[model samples]
Each structure stands twice: as structure tokens, then as C-alpha cells.
Target: MSSHAPPARTHLLIASLCLLGLLSTTGASLPYPILAPLFAGDVGNGLSAFLGLPPKLLLGIALMVNPLGLLIGSAVLGAVSDRLGRRRILLATAIGAAAGHALTAAALVAESYPLFLLARFVTGLLEGNGAIMRAMVVERVEGPLRNHALSWLNGAFHLGWLVGPLLAGFTVGVSITLPFTIAAGALLVGALLAASALERGTAAAKAGERWWRVARERHAFTLLRHAPLRTLFSVHFAYACGVAAFYEFFPLWLVDVGGYAVREIAFVNMGMCALMTGAALFAGRASSTEPRRRASIQAGLAALSILAVGFGSLGVGLAAIVLFGLPHAYYNATVQGWAADQFAGYGQGAVMGLLSTTFCLANIVMALAGGALALVDTRIVLVLGGALALWAALAMRNWSRRAVSVAAQAVELR
Candidate 1:
């Protein structure tokens, strides 16, 4: 290896983490496709009687548990990485995720509901791979390249949601045990890669703020209080609620009401995701060209898309969902870039930790409410989701305008 090869190791490290992040996320997702089948099987049927609960309720319990794990994990683990160094935490969490998957596989084989929940919850808690990988990208890169990296990272997440089930389908014919086992194995490989591939860094050695204490930093909150960030967070958070509602309930609606098979729904979801991935590529280009313009176009598209969904057009629904998601992912990536610009002196790992915290809180609130709303009517779910998007579009318009005004003020002061 050349003298300059260490940094190249960093690159390899990040790439490995990104793929592992994708697999971890995708593996956690595999349960979604198998939920109904598991429910119908002898194991699930027996548990339903023993527990005196509907299978859907059990499935929802398991499905929702992971996101809750994720919301908490993203914050806690992201902060841990900030303090403990990304490498150690990344390795530990990847292993923990592997354990979670193994537990999940064992739970399936043993037909243990409590073990199943514990495994899924633990896996959810270890879901820090996404945030960590993104932070790693931010840590390892600078300037325009950083922006590109975040865009690509965001795309990987979208891609994971798309591919998770397709990969799971291969095992569906053999046995549910196979998919969970594969998931666990993927995570194990990820752990090994993370341990061997990443270079040693000293960020962990510098005694900085504790994970919770980081919230109290003036600069951290100042970044949050900044006019552009304030508006950006609001628009992003509100639109994200709608996005949350869709992801939470759409598949359930199709499978329960539309009478679609689990595999069919996964394919439909894959279609939407493929479209989203394509749109993200385009939106990233627009963001690079002019962020504010791109945000405006995204907001407008989101507004129009929500309106389409409200009209109950599945075609329109699919189209709108993709349009909204594609731009939103780009918008978040650009916001992360802007954050790097505004907080240039700050620790990226810590700053992203806070951002992830804020996002988790937002998702938690929306998901709980969204899940409750699903009990009423799927249309209510769609309407509320659309409404949030529409509101976000309006907020983005004002947000962009305010951002320009603030920049002008800074220039004048200078």
C-alpha cells in the first residue's frame, strides 16, 4: 500500500458501511413481507389463540416496534458515535444488529412472540447504520463531494427499501427461517467488514460532550434556531409526517383491503421506490445547480402530488408518492449540506446526531397518530398525509423566501 492509501481505506470503509447500512435496514424490513404468512402459519395461528390477539395486531406490534427502536436508536447511537468514535460504535452496533437478526430468526423457528418482539426491537435500536454511514460520509469527505456523498447515501436508503423484499422473496419459497438467517448473516459480514476496513481515528479520544449533553451546546441549538434551519426543519418535518403515514399504512391497506398478496405489495412498493431512486438522481442535480430553486420546485411538486393522492387515483397516488419522495430526499440531503456549511467548525457526528434526534421525534409523533388514524379509515390516512405535504409546500415557499432574505442581511452586515 502507498503512503496515501490510508485515506483510500477510509473510502473503502465508508463504502462497506453504506452497503451494510443498506443490508441492515433491508433485513429489518424483510419481516414486513413475511408478516402475513407467519400470521397464517401454524406457529402464528397458535400464538394468536394463545395470546387471544388478531394476527394483524401482532404484525403491527412487531412492525411498529422497529421504527420506535429506530427513532430511539438513531438518536442514542448517533450521539454515541459522536463521543465514542464512529469505528467502535459502528462495529459494535453492526454486531448487535446481527444478533438481533439471529434472535429474530430463532424467534421464528421457535415461534416465540416475546423473543420475536425483543429481537425486532433490538434490531431497531441498532438501526444506527444509516445515520452513522451518512455521518461517516460527512466525516470522510469535504466540499461538493460531501454533498454528492450524502445524496448517494440517501439513495442507498431508498434502494434498500426497494430491494429488501425482493431479496426476502427468494427465501419465501424455501422457508421463512431462510430469509431471517440471511439477514443475520448479512449483518455478521457487515460487522466483520466494519472492523477490518475502517481506519483508526482519534475523534473518540478527545473527550467531548456526552451524547445527551450535546443538546445543550449553544452552537448546536443556534444552528437549530437559525432562520433557514428553522424553516427548513419545519417544512421537512411536516412533509415527513405525510411520508411516515404512507410508509406505515399503505402496504397494510393494500394487503388487508385490496386483497393483494404480501409479495405483490412488495413488488408495488419496489416500483414506487425505483421511481423514487430515479427522481432522487434528478433532484440531486437540481440541488447542486441551485438549492433554493430546487426546493421550490420540490415543494410545488409535493403540493401537486398530494392533491393527486387526495383524488384517490392509484396511478396518481403512485406518481405523487414518487414525486414527493424523490424531491424530499434531495431536499434533506441539501439541508444536511447547508448544515455542514453553517456549522463548519462543529463536529459533524454530533450535529447529525441532533438532526437525527429531531427527525426521530417528528417521526414518532406522526407514526403513533398515523397508526391510530388507520383504525378509522385508510382515506383519512391518505387525506392527512396529503394535507401534511400541502402544508409543507406552503412552508417551503416561505422558507426559501426567508432564506434569501437572511443571506441578504448577512451580506449587508458584512
Candidate 2:
């Protein structure tokens, strides 16, 4: 690992970026454990019961707005990075998003739903630096070492998912807004790290079109119009929908159905994310039809988890939740790597942006759908998620084949 990488600058950049991933993601996910407790911990909190809406419905809206901002940001931010320079944009976003978190905490203190949602939206918009991180890796790291660097980077993100909720669960007892405040500080530290450790380098303008023009002409949604990418996007969307359902409602599942408290739910997430972190470290290794295989494995596990959580006891639910991390890591890594490898011609930033938007879009869709279903039963929401995952995983080959055939027909017609 040490020998293949560039001597000092590259080494520090990767190290800082990895640390930034962990710290920033910790800040990002800190709200996870808090949301369930604050929104649904009891029958309803002031915010959750705001406007006399159902707790789940209110939670759904809270969940939806952040990813909505992400969908918008991922679509547009790549172009901004291209024009502004990735490091500059990243450092600015990291700091800006930290302030956004502080605003979010203020909204919570004020019990203002509108402000809270707006804060979440703006925070997500700034946090849309995933593409920037990927661009940095590709630009700075050369050869196979890039993959290794990416694995480490991804592992840091996974670790953040574990640590964030864990910290929130333990500390939320001090004050409801405490976790968010801590999260804000974590992100500030990460911003400082990025500013100090990273080099201030400008990207070479690759194409004639400036980033602003590119932003207007080609962005995340436009990827859907590309025939070859349609198949890829479809599969990724389905997979993302499944994960989104599981992520958004599982805590509600534990809190309402399983009689678990926020800390308990956090423990469940910690176990799952821990497994995810471990799996990610090795997920970059060999696998046959890796993208398909990974998705299929995840779909199967997801289906099994649905049964375990819905029918089995609380213990079963806990088990299912924790176990999901294994396949999730493999599935995410393979699909992302596959997209990068297969569609680099589309522009690496664009491909990565597509993946981010798809994930964000799925989260938005599932939050609304799951919120509605949770009114009837949370279990039902989990089942629908499983169905989507299954369809994407089991029918992948046939769907892709059919898509290719359709593309061929359209070409002939033209």
C-alpha cells in the first residue's frame, strides 16, 4: 500500500480524505438515532406532532427533504467542482455544511418544522461532495492503488455510519439537540483536516464546455436518456429503493414493534454498520459477475430479513438488522465499481453523480412510500422494499437483456 502510492502528498491526501469521510459521515449519520427517538420515541414530540400530522408521516417528510436536496446537489455540484476546483469546493462545502448543521440544531430548539426541513435541505446540498472525493482519488492516485485507496475511503464511510448513531444513542439523553451539536463539531474538525492536509490543486478543464455550461446541458437526470445506461440505472434504482426502505424505517420498526429504545436501536445499527465496514475492506476482491452477484446476494438477504423481522420476535428483528450489513457492503461496492468501470466514458464525475442521485432519489421515494405504509404497518413497508430488491436482483439478467434488445430495435428504427 505504501510503496505503490506517491511519496508524501498523495499519502497525506488519502489519509486526510479517509479521516474526513469518517468524521463527515459521523456528522451526517448522527441524526439517525436521534430521529427515531425525537420523532417517534413517544406517542409524539412537539415537532413530530406538528400540524397534527401522524408521527410517521412527519418523520417521512423530515427524512425526505434531506435526500431531495442531495438529489439536486449531486446533479449540479459536479459541475461546480469542475469550475471551482475540487479541493476548494470540498473545503468550502465541508465548512458550509457544518454551519448548516448548527442551523438544524437551532431549528430543533425552536421547534420550527419549516426551518428544520430547510436546514436539512441546505446541509444535504453542501454535503453533496461524494463526487468531489471520487474525483480527487482518480486524479491523485494512479493504477491499482486507486482501488486500494477507494476501499480504505469507503471503509471510513462505513465506520462513520457505525459511529454516528452509536454516539447519538449514548448522548441524546443529555439533550435532544446535543447529538446534532456534536455532529456539527465533528464536521468542523473534518473541514479543518481537509483544509490543512489537502493540496490546493485545480483540475484541468477536460472539455471545451465550461462547468456551468456542462451543468446546464448534462447532469444526473440526463443520464437516464442514454440507452446503455438505462439498464444500469434501473437496476441501481431498485437496489437503492430496497436499502432506503430498510434504512429509513428500521429504527421505527425497532422502537414501535420491538420495544427498543433509541440506544438499543443504535446498537442494532452499530452491529450492522460494523459488519458493513468489515465487508467493505474485502469487497473489492474477486467475485463472478460481481455486480449482479452482489446485488443478488443482497436481495436474498433482504428478503430473508423481511421474514425475520416481520414474523419473528424482536430478537429476530435485531438479528436481521445487524446481518444486513454483510451483503449491503458487497452490493454497494460492486455496483459502484461496476458503474465506474463500465461507464467511465460517460465521465467519471457524471457516473459517480448518477450513482449518488439514484441513491438519493430512492431514499426520497421510499421515505414517502414507507411513511404511508407505516401508517398501516411498518412491516408492510419492509416487505415492499424487499419486493423491489428481489425484482432488481432476481430479474436482473432478463431485464438487462430485454433492455439491450429494445435499444437495438430503436437503433434499427432510427
Candidate 3:
């Protein structure tokens, strides 16, 4: 690690970065609580009808656009960050996100669906800062500190989910565009914090290397050639598929099946967030042994599958939401810890970007799929999501055991 700054300064910087993570997710989630009403023509003075598209289709398109942008942005900018530097890229992305959110607010007020979509796309493109931030945390810390930092970052995400919708649920009642405007202002503040507080890190690219060469060399696709990394990537992708489906459709299911109001849904989300936050903090102190981590991940997946099944009962559904938080937090922290280990000497930006890309791609697929399925029956989407998680857990367990056995045999031969 570089020379440590004063304790106070270091703490402040860590806090600011965590806040940035929180703010980023807050902005991203601000639209979800209100999307149903906004696009269904129930809110915003028939805005959905004015757009001349089916409400469900428009909702899917809107949901999908951000991830599509993220997919492209993380792939390109993540590689660029490795060539350039983390702090510089983070600052730029923060500023861009601020502008993008402002544009979205304007587009909403103007009742232009196209502009709104464009704004969301732009914001998502800049939102790849998350990859940079993750890389930064890994670069700055070591050992248990690194694990804690990762946990804190993940907690920030769930906390943002908690606060964003609650804020939207309340503010959206006053003005349909209020939440976006608030998000824009918050992002601007995050940009300022990042600019003033963040320190520069060593660039991943060799000195004098060309950008294209760096990009070509660090291509995430190339990582697949390494068997262990490939296994990790596959497991990450599979796990994300189920998570994406659950998040994309749960709100819709609650509204359609259980007759939840926006504020009520927000309250339930708060419970989920609380559980996630607790789990994240807990994971930071828990053992970081590989076996324990893998077991935690598997257990989380199994619990998630059960949660999906429980969605059929209202009381059970709410309980499941709360219960799912621990596994979610454990799975996230463990996977991230593993990824950090894999990319220790490699380009953090590029590798994390690839992971983010996997996540975004999953989101795009699940969002569209969930939307289509909702028209038929929203519960079906949840059931399918559960099945996917169960399958992924089984596959991951098998692969993990095989890896262990191979290692044991190799040790005996040596």
C-alpha cells in the first residue's frame, strides 16, 4: 500500500467513496417505484398514453436501456480506466452522471419518452464508475480491511435501494419529476466529493502503451482462457441471472397480485434493505476462508430459491424479502472477495468491468423477459427465477467440489 495518510483523512476518503456508491444506486433506483404509475398512465397526466406505446412495452424498454448502456460503457470505459487511471475516470463519470440525471429530469417534465430514455442511457453509461470504485477500494486496502471495504460498498448499495424508493414514494406525490431532480443534485454533490477527496492510483497499463493495445490486451474475453477465472465468471453470471429476474419483477408482482401501494412497497423494501445492511456488516467480521465463503454462497442461492417460491403467499412473500437479505449480502461479498483475489495483479478496472458487464447483460435479459411474462402472469416469472437459482447452485456446488478434488490430487502427486 502507498504511504498512509493521516487517519482522519483516510477515514474521510473511505466515507466519501462509500457515499458515492450509495448515491449512485440511489439515482439508479429512483425511477423504479414510480415507473408503474408513470408508464401506466395512472400518474404524470397520462404520460404513458401520450408516448403512443404500450405501457408494459415502454416500461421494459426503459428498464432495458440503462443496462444496455452499462454493458457498452463498462466494457469500453473500464478498459480505458486501466490505461488512464481510476481517480480521473471516476471524477469524469461522476460529472457525466450528474448531467445525465438532470437531463432525465428535464425530459420527464417535458413529457418526452425518447429524451427520458436517452437520459437514462447516458446516465447508465457514466454509471460504470462503479467498476472503477471497486477497483479503487481493492487498490487502497489489504487483508481484512479490504473485506470490510467491500462489505461496506455492498451495504451502500442496499442502503441506496432503501432510501431511493422511500424518497421517491414521498416526493413523487408532490411532483412526478421531483425524484429525478433530487437525484441529479445528489450526484453533483458526489462528483464534488470525489474530486476533492479521491487520490490517484497507479495506472494498470504499461508506460507509453497505446490505448487500443491496452484495450486489446486486457479484453475480458481473454480471461476465459484461464480455467479458474472462467469458472468464477460462469458462476457469477449464473447467480446474477436469478438476482436480476427477482429485482426486475418483484415490485410489479407486489402491485399486481398483492395490491401494494408505492409507499407500502417502499416500506417492505426498507425491511429488505435493513436485512441486507446487517448481513453486509456481519460478513465483514465473518471468516474469509474459502470453504466458508463457498458454503455461504451456496446457502444463499438455496434460500433465494425458497424465497421465490414463497412469493405466492403475501405474509410469506414479505418474510421472504426480509430473509433473502442475508444470503444476498453474503453472496455479494464472497463473490467480490473472490474476484478481487483473481484480479490482484491484473487490471482491476478491466476485470471488474467484465463482471459488471455480466450483471448488466443479465439485467437486460431478465427485465425484458419479466416484463413479457408479467402480461401473462407475474408469478410465473418469480417461479422461473427460483428455478434458475436452484440450477445455478447445483452447478456451482459440483464445480467447486471438482476443483477441490483436483487440487487435493495434485498435492498428493507432488
Candidate 4:
């Protein structure tokens, strides 16, 4: 079936998948620009009063819920997509995400904190299409083209991050509830595009294999049992922890410490996103070798750590944030490429699901920890996150050396 398709159709399929990724990321990030001020009783027409909880605590819970949902969704839907087919999962989840976003908007308008949290959770759960979409990309393309396709998808995600906050900033000025609605509409568009463009590939199930059993068999926990895969997952988890912490609280710091407005935050993020996109593209082209990829990852981690510590002066800090983008892009592209090479045989959906679970778990920890630390000093959270990234960089270096030694010994024996 795939062989007979026109090149145009294939290109359309890839474009649609990338668009879906962009929309999903944009929807996921749409709430961030205003969340701090809105929940802190500083914006959104006193929305925080309805929650009757401390702003930091409420914000923490709100942030934590999404990753919790992502953890479950990535584990469950990612595995399920393997059995049920990627197209179907993508279709369903995209629609579900739209609904969740609508609900979030309604909750905001009605000032219902619990409803808002539930909506965010639902959105995260349904956004598991990331893994499914990645699997679809893998199924449709192969060889160098596959890597390029994945890089484009990653770029799409960064592009979304670039645009989402900017849209939120504009919309919030008009109406705080508007961004959610806009995100919902965009996701709906993605769903329609997926429904039209995506082709269902071979399902992962064998004859008489129950769906639940298949999901359990491909669980992220099962993947962790492999030594090399485990090492990779650990490194990814550590990096994600730091990134999540830095991202979630960085806005809060900007508002509280740097005295920046939402528009200014958006502008800074736009610069970061631009750099990130450039870095992703450069990494895709330049870091093709294993040794180079490892070096890129190490260098990125070190730069990230240094940048986190240098956020005292707002101007300097914003510059650091922008510069941090290069390393950020390098680490993400390198590690993701390495993981793809390592896990291509285990079912792309399953592998991506496991990776998503690792990311979500890290986000959950950092969200809570960052929030608590913010009460004392936001700088502490940033420092701790930097320390974690540095540790992971050191750990990856050691692991790489051991892997090289083992390979060398195997070569000698052969």
C-alpha cells in the first residue's frame, strides 16, 4: 500500500504529522505565560481567590497534574497505539485534546480551579499522540530520511513553543480565557488534518493477543531492564528533570524577580525558541557521529548549568536564557537520535512512550520541587536543577567510556 502512494501523498502525510506535533506542543504550552500571574491573584480578574489556596501550592498542583497525566497517557496510549494502530490513536487523542482545552477555557471563565486542573490533566492525557505520531513517522520513512523527518518534527515542537507563548500573551491582553479556546481550535484542526492525511500501518498485536496484555508487555518499566537502554533512559530523565524545572519556574522568576511583563516574557521565549530551532537544525546536520553527539550533549549540559547560575541581572539573565538554547537543542537532538538508534527494534511507539514517561516523571518532580523552593527562593531551584544536569553530564561521560571499553574488548575477542 505504501509503495503505490504518490510522492506528494507521502509528503502530505509527513507534513500533517509534523503539523500535529506542532499543534500538540502549542496547546500544551499555551497556559504557561499567564498561569503564574493568573493563579497568584495578580491577573485574570482575581481568579486565584476562588481556589482558596496559596498561589504557589495551587500552581504546583496544576503543573504537577499535567505531567501525571502525561506519564499515564504516554505509558497507556503509547502502548495501546501499538496494538490499535497509530492513526486511530492520533485521531482520538487529538479530538480529546481539543475537548480538554475547551473545558479548560470554560473553567477559566467560570473560575473553577478544580475544573481547570481536571481539564489540564485531560489535555495531557490525550496529548500522548506525540509517541504515536513519532511511530507513524518511523513507519513511513527509513534510513537518513527518517532522521531528517524526526528532526523536522522536533523543530515543529520548538516552533510551537515559540509561537504558543506569544499567542498567549496577545490573547491574555484581550481575554485570559481566549488562549485556551484558541488552542482548542488549533488542536481540532490538527485532528481533522490527521484524520484525512494519516495512513494506518501494521498493528503490533499478534493473533489472539489482548490489547491490555500487549500494553503491559511493552510498558516503560519493562524497557528499563535493559542495561544500555536503562543508562540512556537515566540520562534522559536527569536532563528532563533539569529542563522541566528551569522551564516551569523561569517565567515565575521573570515576573517576581526580573519584574517582566507577559509580553516581555513572550519576547524572551521567542528568542530562546529561535535559538533552539537553529540548534536543532545544526545538531541534525553536524552531530552525526556518536562521539560528536556525546560531546555535544556534555557541552550542552555544562553550558546549561552555567547559564542557570548566571541569572542575577535581568539583562544578563535573558541573554543567558537565549544562549542556553544552543545547548538545549544539541542535547535534545543528540540524545533523541541516540535513543532512536538504540531502540528502533522495540517498536517506535513503545520506545517513545517509555521516553515520554521518563520526561513526565521528571516534570512531576521538578514541578513540585520548584514550586516549594520558589517560596523560599527561586534561585535555589534553578541552582539545584543545574546541579542535576551537571551530574547527568558526568554520568553520561562515564557511561560512554564504559561502553567504548566493552566494544573494544568485543572487537579484540572477535
List RMSD in Å for every model shown: 4.0, 5.1, 3.1, 3.2
> What is the per-residue lDDT of model 2 for residues 166-192, given as tens digits with 9 covering 90 to 100?
787688889878888887888888788
Estimate, for each residue in 214-260, the C-alpha lDDT of model 3 and write its tens digit.
65776556667877768766777766777777777777778876899
Ranking by TM-score: 3, 4, 1, 2
Question: Can you write out model 4's per-residue Cα lDDT over 170-246, one digit (the tens) per residue?
Answer: 78888877888888898898788778886666664678887677666776667778877787777778777877777
Worst 10 residues of 3 by lDDT: 288-297
TM-score, prediction 3: 0.88
Model 1 Cα shift for residue 401 (angstroms): 2.2
Better of 2 and 3 by lDDT: 2
Write out the backbone clash pairs for model 4: none
lDDT of 4 at 28: 81
Error of 1 at 92 (Å): 1.0
Candidate 2: pairs in clash: none
Residue ranges of candidate 4 with Cα displaced over 4 Å: 1-7, 36-38, 42-59, 173-176, 204-217, 252-257, 286-288, 291-308, 311-315
| Residue 94 displacement in candidate 4 (angstroms) | 0.6
Model 1 Cα lDDT, one tens digit per residue, 25-45 = 687677766776677656534
Looking at model 2, report the run of 10 residues with the lowest lDDT sum.
Answer: 1-10
Best by TM-score: 3
